[model samples]
Structure formats: C-alpha cells, structure tokens
Target: MPAQPFTALAIGEAIRRGELDPVALTRQCLTRATDSDAVFISLTEQRALVEAEACAQRQRSGTLRGPLDGVPLAWKDLFDIAGTATTAGGKVLGKTPAERDAEAVRHTAGAGMVCIGKTNLTEIAYSGLGLNPHYGTPHHTPPPTSSEHEHESRNENEPRAPGGSSSGSAVAVAQGIVPAAIGTDTAGSLRVPAAFNGLVSYRPSQARHSRLGVTPLADSLDTIGVIASTLEDCLAIDDTMRGSAPLVRAAAVPEQSVIVLDAGCLDDPRVSRAVGDNLEACASRLKDAGFHIVRRRVASVADTLEAITRHGWLGAAEAYTEYRALLEGPDAEAMDPRVRKRLEAARQMPPDSVVSLYRLRQALKTRLREELAGATLLTPTVAHVAPLLAPLEADPEHFSEVNLATLRLSMVASLLDSPAVALPSGRDDDRQHTSLQLSGPCGEDEALLRVALGASSALTA
Candidate 1:
C-alpha cells in the first residue's frame, strides 16, 4: 500500500530513512495548490523548490538537519514569507514583498521545512467567519471519499465559512493537500478553523511561538499557532516554532490532575451539546487510564465571559490600530461593511479604556492560574457551530449581538495567557464539526496538545 500523507514526525522519519525527497514533496504541494480553490494569495514555488532540493542534497550527504527538514507548510498570509506580499487579506497591502520570512518561519526553515506559499485569511483577521470577498474563501471540505462512510452532499447555500484568518490553512490540511500549516490567533482565529475543518489546532501561550515576522494584530495577544491533522503532528511543528526546544510538555500538564470547566456561556445549542458529550467521554477515558479527572466550575467563568465583550483588549483596540490608515483610503469602499464598523468602534473607545482592559486582562490571567492551580481546564472551543452568513447579512443587528457568544470561551484562553488546544468533538445532527477546548498554564502548549491526543479522534468518528 502507498504511504499515508505527511505528518511532521512521519515526514521527518521518511526524510531520515532516504525514502522521501524534499524536492518531490514541494512539487507535490505546489501541484495541489494549483488545482485547488486558489486559496493561497501568493505562492513561493521557486524559493521552496530551491530550498527543498538543497535539503534533498543534504540528506544524501549525511548532513541531515533537525526534524522537519524539507517538510512543507502553508503560511497564513499575515506572516511575512521573504518574497511574498504580507497582505493580511487586504487590497491595500498590494504586492510589496518582504526581505525575509517571519522569525517562526525562519525557525521552521532552520528545522528544514520548505515554505510552499502564503494562505488566505479574513480581511485584516477581524471576522470569525472566513468569507473573504477580498482574496477568496477556501471550500470547507470533509475528509476525502472512502467506500464505507456515508457522506453529506455539499450545501452550497446552507452556510459554509471555513472560520477565519487561518481559513486556507485549515482547508488545505483537511483536504489532504498539506500535512500542516501555520496561522496567527488573537481572537480565536486558529482554533475556530481547526474546529470547522475537523482538524487539530494548537495556540501557544502568548509569545511562546515567535512573532518576529508576523504582521501585528494585537502584539500583546498575538500568538502563532499550528493547524494539523493530529495532536502529535501539531506538537512536532510547535517544538520547531518555539525559541527554546523543550524536552517534553510534561511539566506543563503534570501527571497530577485535570479539570473540566462547566463552560455553558456558549450560545449555539449544537456546539454546547457536542462539548458536553465529549467532555464526559474524555473524562471517563482519562479516569479509566488512571489519570485524575476533576470536575470543577472555575471562578473565572465570568472573566472568561468578559474576554469576548466589546471592551476587551484584542477586540476593539487591536482592530482600530490595524486599520487606521486603510480606513481613510479610496479603497475603503471595498472593505467589509461590518468589519469596517467594528474598527470604527475602536476609535471611539477612550485611551483610558484600553489601559483598563489590559489591567483587567492581567487580573484575569492571575485568576485563571490560581483557579487552575497547575491543573488543566477543558471546555468547548466555541459556543456554537459556524452561523449562516445570510443571517448575518440579513440581520446585521443579530450578528453583532451573537458574535460575542460564539467567542466567549476562546477569548478567555487568549486573555488569560494560557496555552490552549481545540480538539474535535463529534459532528452535530447537521454534520457540522465541533471542538472541545483544553487549556493549560502560561506556557504549557505541549501539555495541552498531549492531553488532546486521545479525544480528537471523536470529532468526526
């Protein structure tokens, strides 16, 4: 039988064993990109080909670099990719190229990965829904066909948003075109799409993954996260992205205890049900395996809820700063009306209000640590599945009202500075995927990824 598609560890081993050539792998990804929805805004085909051939030569010469040598990754457009334009999904950025890839991309390069190209994103990474009239939304597809499983027919009008910012990255991995991709998160950007695509995603604790080449959304809240097919695959990529390599993520999750949050702030009934069901199932599995599973309603539930409110730091403040110049340009007519309105709200916020939001953020971070006491907290990634864009388009007021509800729990993981991972919960009656969220202390990315290992299989199965 032919080998399974790339997983970071699998690909690394294949490279070491002389069974896979980086050049061949890069070409394969480039071919896939060409036939797909044109989801990538720009392709680094020439450069990636050059790097992959070099890696192939290095392997034969017995000078193998570290793991991920010659592996391919689809970069979210916000990250500078050396020669590609860093147009965080805006018409204004044009084709002005970068001199070098972002620090995280450089780190991945150091590990021997080839950059295939830049993926599509939300307009300025503002909206949760992945609909981009600017670049193009990648189709949210289920895993490829197999004879045994019954598949749902595509509903072109029902609703399909691949979940923003990381939209193309998630779609690429889910459709089996790539093994892994990188995306940035401020307000649930990375995890949302991972859930939508039924893949695994990891959001490192703030600054845990390097931010040197990433265009700033909210510097304090910005985190570079990975979207991959599995937990172990994500871990392999995360280790390569971090500044200092960790021996293991064990210290962050300690063998001691795990807690499940009574996180009911989610507005979508389908999302709430999927999370509740999966959390119970995960808790039972952990207990049966001799892991201490604690059921606790955390005190910071209110603070977690507050993180999604309009006045929060990553919300209005960051959006306002990101678009200050663009909002004045002639092309402002091309901007999404709703996105434009949100950024405009940021301008009205008092300077003092932004400061207070940061202070509250610090307080919330401390609150989560004390509440968790070095234990892990698990919940659902979103309050609901992706809502129909028609409803938002038809009832603008309703969209504004419910956006907070969808992001409620995720914003907590971001605001509290905890490392978080979104595991797939089973699909709903509608067959839309749901994600169960697990969070760890300030820098516990690896631990969150590990704990999520066993349960993620349930999301679609």
Candidate 2:
C-alpha cells in the first residue's frame, strides 16, 4: 500500500494533471474489488468502464465535471443503480433490476464519479454489528506495518466484527479498494462501521439529502451518508451527492465551544474505559488547538435514553411497520433470522406507544437544539471498539446485546435528527480503533462538518 492512500479529491487532481487515467483507475478498482471478500454484493463493471471512458475523453478535452470527476466509489446495496438490484444485503428484497438510478446516484454520476459496485450490508440494514448471514460479513485486518500491529501480537489479526449495516462500504474504503463509499444510517450504521475500521463517516441531517430510490429501513430516521478515508473525502462526496458547490474549508472559529459529554453521567457499564480515555485525549487535543471545551451532562442525552426506555426505539417501530408484511409473509423464513427476530419484536410495541415515541422524538429534538445552543456535542461514537466476529456469530443472544450497546450513542443523534461526524480518535492498547462523534443542531450540517474538520486535523497533527 502507498504511504498515503489516495483520497477522492487527490484522485481527481491526479487525473486532471495527467498523472492518472480514469479508465485505468476504474479498471484497477474493479480488479481490487474482485478480492474484497464479500465487500461488494455486485459490481457495475460495464457501467463503471463506460463512465470512466467518458471521463477520460472529457479530461482530454479539458471539460472535467468537478473535483471528484474521475473518482471511483461504491454505494451501499440499498441504492438503485439502474439495471442492478438494490439488494439491501438480503436475498429476498430487490430481486428485480432497477430501471433508473437513485437520486443520489444520479447526482454523483452527474459529478463524474465512477460507480464500481453495490456494497453489502446487514439485511435491510437493521444491525450495527455488521454480521451478514446471507452474504459473508466484511472484516478489516490492519497491515503488518500499521500502528495496530506495533502494540499487539500478530494474533490481533483475528477477524472482528465490521460495524454495520454499512459493513461492506467501510471495509472497502479501509482496504483502499475505494476512496469513499455511500451508505445509509438509521441508528449508527455508517458511523459504527467507520469507527470500527478507523475511518471517517458523516451522517448529515435526514432532510439534507434526497432519499429517493433508496430502500427504507426506517422512514423518519433513515439517512444517507458517506464513509471515507478522510473528512475531506467525506465532505467532497457530500457536496457531490447534494449537487451543491464545494464548501470552503475554514479554520476552527476562535474559542468555539465544544461540549464534551461527561462520561460519568452515562453510567453504562458497556462503555469501555478505553473509549472514555480516548475521548478525553481527543478533547484535550481540541482544547490545545484553541477550542473551548466544556464537560457537563447534556440533559437531552439522558432524556432521550429515558424516553426510549419508556416508549421504545422509534426507528424499530417504524422499521417493523415498514416490513411487517415481509416478517409475517411466507417468505419470512428466507430472511436472516437475526434481522427477522429484531423486526418482529417490534410487534410487541403497542401502536400507541409507537405514537408516543414519535411525539417524544420531536420534543427531544427541540430540547436538544436549545441545550446545544450552537455548541457541538462530542461523545464516544460507540461504547466499545468492534468485538470479535466469532463470539457474535456463534451466540445470537450475545450478538443482540452488543448490537444494541454499539448503536446506543449514535442512536441519540439519529433520534434527534442531528447531523453528526464520527472521527477516528485513536487506537486502544489492543490496537482496536476508538471513535469520537461530534454532532450539531439539526440542519446545521455545514457547521458540524467544519467542526469535525478542525477536530480531525487537531487529532492527526
């Protein structure tokens, strides 16, 4: 591997400078994707080559589309890609080929990004653990020369859980198969996988991007996002998907307030000591870089947890309603038993309770915005690093517990409809990656990204 992996923007610049060939780049990506170990459910070989060829011609003509003109990316299988089926990592759903590209797909294609393939995910994107019974789960083993290998025995290479339901997308980028991949997050799907794999993920406000042509797991909470090698790569893809001009990078505002959620208040035994330590280290870095760090309990966090305990996960209730027929239908047996069980459990949630959860979500969102008061909220993205895959695969009960715990913190941002960025904080003594999440008020996607950029730079520096 190269000392510095190519980012989407770097690839585009190389193409423009005649240092790279779009067609050749696309072919190389396609070749690598062949050995992705189930990372891709299907590859768009013909379409990608055709797009690459056109991009090459445009490059020669000096009429490139944009900064990411010749970059190659993978989409989570949930997005419609014209003739390919949007599998959503299930054998039963999306059996037929789509007739048109999804709205987000069209936007990226319009910006000249090559679509290498559709990546795998949890069935219907329902789990954060990233284990897929139908398609093999995607896992990342760090390179021997990487920091992960420095502190641990070679045994650390054991296959571990790839955070999901965006499992394949995160693995693809982490393995350098693609600079960036698009995925959906309802309850930390994108961020969890990225956190586990030591990458960056951005979950924009739900309404920030068009969800058309995308499969629905939970209508209200389902959000399209990107997982990539860098914050710049994530922001560039975000711009392309939104069909907006690139956002100008700005320096961290002087004395900008960043609220570090007090770990003591969480009182969750599942939160590892390593996660808390890494979060504090990250907070210290930001403080050294001139950001105002405030440590206190955010009332909204506690309130959201209490409300969910009282009512239940709004997304689960919504997902249950979305797939109730499939769960009850004759085809139910064909689905992943784990995913099926989860969706079916929502049946016990009374309809009135579901309604109350929705109402509570709105109230919580309002309270959260006021509490945040323009200061970004920083918390551990997941309570712990990714767990080993064997135990999770062998014990379904263990899987359920870890899955809920892994999604706990990220779910708060989802329930409140806040835009969030998950950054790789640092590796633990065991060489596992820990993640820090920074979220801002709903609809403040740009501001959140800027803060994330500053935080990322501070940590990396």
Top-scoring candidate (lDDT): 2
Weakest ten-residue segment in model 1 by summed lDDT: 245-254
Model 2, residue 135: displacement in angstroms? 1.5
Poorly placed runs, candidate 2 (over 4 Å): 1-3, 143-149, 264-267
| Candidates in order: C-alpha RMSD to true structure | 3.3, 1.6
The residue-by-residue lDDT of candidate 1 on 1-461, one tens digit each, is: 02354586788779889998778878888988888794788888898899899899889998877767878888988888777789888776646889987888888888778888888887778766676777666767644334446555554236566787688888888766678999988878899889878778888888566688788777778888899977777887888877444234432232454655554433335456765675567666656654566665676756566544546545668768866887878877778776777787778887776877777777877877788776678777876666666666566677666565555667777777788888776565556777778887777655566556544433323
TM-scores of the candidates in the order shown: 0.89, 0.97
lDDT of 2 by residue, 324-403 (tens): 99988898999999999999898899989888888888888898888878888888899888888999999999999888
| Distance from true location, Cα of 111 in model 2, Å | 0.6
Q: What is the lDDT, from 0 to 100, of the residue 267 in candidate 2?
A: 56
Best candidate, TM-score:
2
Clashes of 1: 4
User: For candidate 2, what is the TM-score?
Assistant: 0.97
